[model samples]
Target: MAPTATRSPWPRVGAIVLLLTALLSVIMIAFAWPATRSSVHDIPIAVAGPSAATAQVAQQLSAKRPGTFDVTVVDGTAAAERLILDREVYGAIDVSSGHPQLIIASAASPAVAQALQQVAQALGGTDAGVPVRDLVPLPADDPRGAGLAAGALPLVLGGIAAAGVLTSLVVGVARRLAGALAFAVTGALALVAILQFWLGSVEGSYWLNSGAVALGIAATALTILGLESLLGAAGLGLGAASMMLLGNPLSGLSSAPEMLPSGWGTLGQFLPPGAAGSLLRSTAFFDGHAAAPHVWVLLGWAALGLVLAGLAAARTARRPAAAEPAAEAVPATVAV
Candidate 1:
């Protein structure tokens, strides 16, 4: 019998790459999305005074504003002031005096402080004597009143950068789909912990944070995987470009979504970064108020990716139409 021929190994490797790429891309996108940050509400503020007084005030504030601020109780006004200096509280209340004083410290989200001021003034006399000042002040280089521009932003962006680079490596040639997914999930969880618990960007429910992290990674990866499924490796570049350049700044990562151009603010939620960012905000700061919208958006993206990837595989199995070169003229007349 004639010797059996060994098959070329390239197509097998390509198939493996595509599978691994899909799973890995899903994970990477999840980590790239920033955690929740509301330009409007749920700012952390410390409260200090007699337990009775502070409790009443906190209850009153929540009752009036509902979801605007989360009041964290401190030992005393001194402690509240200290928390402000430590960047722990967006604003503070000292109910020690006959007319309680309000302290607004965080410059990053002055609207939060301003909102608190209105509430405090409505309850008490005036924040005119409440001593509103910037304690752990914003850097001169920053224009955003919030100091987050310098500190938390770098930390957040650093996490995204690392995730992207590592994802590129793992997804480029890996053949294990589960491993790729694990890599992305782990990266996003680590980043979520850093920002939410360790770094103090937010304080919220653990399940909410976990969900947010999962969505963040899923959104980024889905977009990337969709492109790769359509255009192979080149799609990775396009996805990265869309996420880092077009998505971040426009998504309002450094500020409130509404603060950007009107159209951008409205449409940012449609982008992966925007969807993830909104999802993060819902868990971290919004007290799950707007969670439904973002959940559906990210979930839709994830589902779309799965569907498209499946279709691409099926399409790839079909043979493309064969093209034949023009017939030779038999050297025109030489045959005769």
Candidate 2:
């Protein structure tokens, strides 16, 4: 018989190279696109002054960067400050006393604050610098909020790692899940301590901050664990990729969500990473204002993951029972 032809190694090698290239390209786009395309688009900012002055200021802002700022006219600076504290606005342009003053909440978003500062400078023309007041300043040790932004990736990676370890090392579904939860709690505590006490990135009640971090880690780890339990190795890969690629880049942790082009920012807030970052920020600085929505999102993800895990566990439990009858029949046949 004629020998069968072997497949060419070059084709397999080429395919691998192509696949790797495609993956790298996607990763680059995910991480770089948002940052490069970032710009102010309908970002909420209050204007506090008389009707005529506020209208003119609003018109100028629109003319300068059309559709950039969603200008809300308020009665006075007091009203504007309330909105900022409530997380309704990023910053405000106050012309209440016939002089423009810039009120910023740097803790909410340092990027937005810087943008507003530039706008404030422009408003002052060449005469003098605009009077600036930071309503919510970041911690003295970490004034840029670099630590807080940098902390987001580690949390995501830690949760992914937790899921991997539990799935691989733990024997039963219940045990794996318990381990994941325990890791979430302990990991959150450790991370929060480092960020809060050591790095000075986070502020507010320690317990509250720890709780936020724990919930975020739990939501991520449980979701990944559920996927792994249900679909095995493939499920784990899917979960990890989704969290890293789709969730992390769109998280808006490094910058305000509104800064992202299109509606991706809003969509990010619905995902685990984004929700976690926003929730943590709120708890740390805003006293939990505007935190309910993010809390619900995380809870929803965790609940769904639990349901998936239960289904997988049920399936695993049934396999042994189904196999028992076949084994018993095998002994009878062997005796015959």
**Top lDDT model:** 2
Tens-digit lDDT track for model 2 on 220-310? 9999999998999998999999899988989988999999987999999998999999999999999999899999999988887788899
Off by over 4 Å in 2: 1-8, 318-336
Model 1: residues >4 Å from true position, as ranges?
A: 1-180, 320-336
Candidate 2 lowest-lDDT run of ten = 327-336
Task: Give a tens-digit lDDT track for model 1, residues 1-336.
Answer: 999998869989899999899867755643343233234555678888888988898898888777666689876868987666544566787887645777874343444556667777787754464555555433243324333332333323433443345445554322322333564477667766766556556446766776666666666665566556667767656776666655665565456554454455557677666666656655654356556777888778667655666666566655342222223423555665
TM-score of each: 0.50, 0.93
Model 2 lDDT on a 0 to 1 scale: 0.92
User: Which window of 10 residues has the lowest lDDT sum in candidate 1?
Assistant: 321-330
TM-score of 2: 0.93
Give Cα distance to truth, residue 238, candidate 2, Å. Answer: 0.7
lDDT of each: 0.60, 0.92
